[model samples]
Target: MASGASTKEPAAAPAATAVPDPKMPPPEKPADVRRRSYVILSFWLIVLLLGLPIWWMTTTIYRANLPLDGMIDWADGKACRPVFPLQISIQADALQPQEAQHLVRLIQHAIDDLNDFSGHHLRLQLAPKDDRRIVQKDNPELALTVRLKAGEATTASLDPHSAALDITYPSNAIPSPTSTSSPLATYIANELRSTFSEEQSIISYLLSTSSMSSDVRPQSLTPTDLAELDKRMTRSLRYAATYHLTFSLFADGSTPNTWDIEEAVEKYMRPLLDVLSPIHNFTVDTQLQLYATPGVQSQVLHKEDLASFINAAEWPLSPSIGGAPTVNFVIFAGNQTIALGDSESSAETSQSWLIPQWGTVYLLSLPDATSHVSSNILRQPMLTFGGHLLTLLGTPQAGSLPLRLSALTRIRSADLLLRSSSTLGSLARLSRSLPSISIPRTVADGVATSMYHLERACSNLGGLEGLMHARIAEEEAERAFFEKSMVGQLYFPDEHKVAVYLPLLGPVGVPLVLGLIKELKQWSKKRKEKAKEAREKKQQ
Candidate 1:
């Protein structure tokens, strides 16, 4: 009983208490945790705000603005309708002015009745027949003057060099003001129509080839004619403001090195070039290449050999340095005959074969001892080459040289217009297809320029201005569609982006976020404990 009492009394005594020493300064006051937290928050804010903006700004590409919708519209033939208005003046020198007017009116009415195409219109004007002083001059004031001379019967013939229609009509065949139709008037109208029929057909074909109205296409173009057109198109080079015509003498062996090309070109080719000057500028340069070898080295060239006869890689017939299109006319001195593959056994072999979109190659059989190509020997080749060049440039087969060249200008302009439109369409489609590709300001500028030029070309489709504008439009459209900035960057795959970000963001962000979260939790807990202690103190 005594031991039990001593144990209970001893429990009432104050338990032994352990106190901390005062010299340690309470574990340094926890190192100002709020200040450390403020420093870390400021560091994270700077990293998030200031650093990323600069990096993103530096890595981006400069994109231009292009009128994609408008470009597509133009490409789709929704904009710009092409029209060709031809002015035909008639000068009836022998007839009275009133009679000439009546005749012109009648012919115009007949022409209108005969014409079917709505896009092309032929407006007739009567020139002063009494202006003999002007008509006799070397430079006449007329496109075509109808000299109605008295004859046994009415007949018409065009002047070889001039745009003159000589109509010799009998005095009795003249139409009266009251007559609706006359043999003379019908003959004149039919002749004029016949003369311009080829031009009309060609223009119709061109319009059909282009993205023109579907309603106005010609129905008379046969498959043979279409095939011919295709061949002509394939043979022709793309139109340019200036064409560099290179006349090269390529010989299989090292003989006939020299040529009188300057004289020959001046005498033979210069006239045609001068004639074509109005439509296109021609730059001529001749070269004599020796020791040139053919691609197929055979004594007797088969018909198929002609296709691969010219050594494309080895020949020095490279394009000219100028920006203009280069047309190479080569004359090889070898005795190889070229025949068509379809007619292998035919003796009617061709002496020359045209390289599509290039120039012509003439297989000249010359004596081995010949050292120089005389102008006489070059005459036929030069003429043939000139003809081929005309064909290659898409000159109309019918009509006089001047008329054909005029048609060629119109054709080229149409081609350029269509090509530019197509390019714009492609650009618009590309912009739509690749949404991520940035459209640059340069591309916008190019598109604008192209559209402007396209409009100008459309307005002036029959003249030199049309050609210039069409060319500019084509070049600009090409530039806009192929803008380098638009294709600068690739769409980064999601997997690749994740691969790049995971490496740095995974390790760095995890620790940073955890550290901040832990610090916040500790601070909240401490605040709660302080509040509870303050309440307890106040209550005591």
Candidate 2:
């Protein structure tokens, strides 16, 4: 019965019967296929015309219009030529007006003949005989005043206290109105030239250091002069409109920590600070630091060891929290002596050394038991610091503090002008060299501001206005060259860009490729069908 039932079940299972395949609705109609193609084409057209442009506009960086040619011209020194017209007033109260005027003409001619540098020239003007003393006070542009006096021999001496050149000439040395030249005239010209030689050298050095061609540079600088200029330049601090003067008393031990710094500064340094007010604004602060250690472990500090004795890493010599630069004047209480090798023995030598562009350090040897420093003890140190300050500020070593400060203003203006121009040139070159680097609108704005200020500063070269403009130009140029956005572009590469864009592009690109392939297949099919219809007609 079981075998019969299995046989019946096998028989119920149909042999060689094919299940019908599921029928497709039908081959798509030509119209329907064309409509589907149109839909895909429309989708891609929307993506290409609308989506791509929107994405590019939204993601791109903003770059402002820049005066590239103008900036390059300024940087190359083709736009402006710097000229210094120095006005000198001659005071000859001892002589008649006509005679003084004659002497002045002759001296002026002699000076003109002697001057080789066209950029810097001296012009002579007669001082008002009615009020000789008021000449400098009245004319702020007067660079020097020559006072004539009758004496035994023709001689010239610079006033220690004023910017006056005192000339003591013999009675016969005075040039007559008819004379074209005289010993007195030549002597005055030569003396004036000698007085300004150092200044001329400095200006020449500055011009040489700039981007200007050799045509504008003075060719008279000897190797020694250049070396001296380099030394002075390296020793000086960068120009700043404001400086923070920090007076610090550092002691290895707790004793001798208290100092009369305020009194000392008021008595000794105030006059200089007041004179320097026009060129730089200085803020003074005092501090007392105890248990300070020197960087060098040597008991006796040598000349070479002085450089590393400041303990810059450990010392509280941070720059002030404003735009101004800091100049530290440290007075350390220690027994460390600077040994002068192979020099004649002296009971006392210089107890101070100046750090270039930094400040002065005075090693004071005081009694170990002493706990205070008096103003009297600080007098010499204060004087030393004042002198060092002048050096650090690029003050002329030959002139009085007043004259040096005036020169400093002019020097700083020149420095800033060159610096701005050089920065602009560097930026231009960098832009041309780096095609991928992005320039922001802020950089363009800063460049424009710098150029504007540079123009103003160039127009008014030796005045306070020039200094102000130059300072602004330097700051703007620096800001533009160091734009944060510009630097950020360097970290983003092409691969990074591809990675960032791939996610959005992948889905859209796939649909586009598929639609294109479908359209090509339809076109081929239409061509084959048309060929087949032509063949059929021919056969019929």
lDDT of 1 by residue, 397-441 (tens): 765666566667667777788789888888888777776577878
Candidate 1: deviation at residue 473, Å?
Answer: 1.3
Name the 10 consecutive residues with the lowest summed lDDT in model 1.
Answer: 135-144
How does model 2 fare in lDDT? 0.84
RMSD of each: 6.1, 6.5
Residues 257-329, candidate 2, lDDT per residue (tens digit)?
6889999999999998987887888999988989999887665666788878989887788587487789999
Candidate 1: residue 483 lDDT (0-100): 68
- For residue 97, model 1's alpha carbon misses the true position, in angstroms, by 2.4
What residue pairs are clashing in model 2?
none
Q: After superposition, how far is residue 200 of candidate 1 from its true place, in Å?
A: 4.1
Clashes of each: 5, 0
The whole-model lDDT of each prediction reads: 0.76, 0.84
Residue 474 deviation, candidate 2, in Å?
A: 1.2
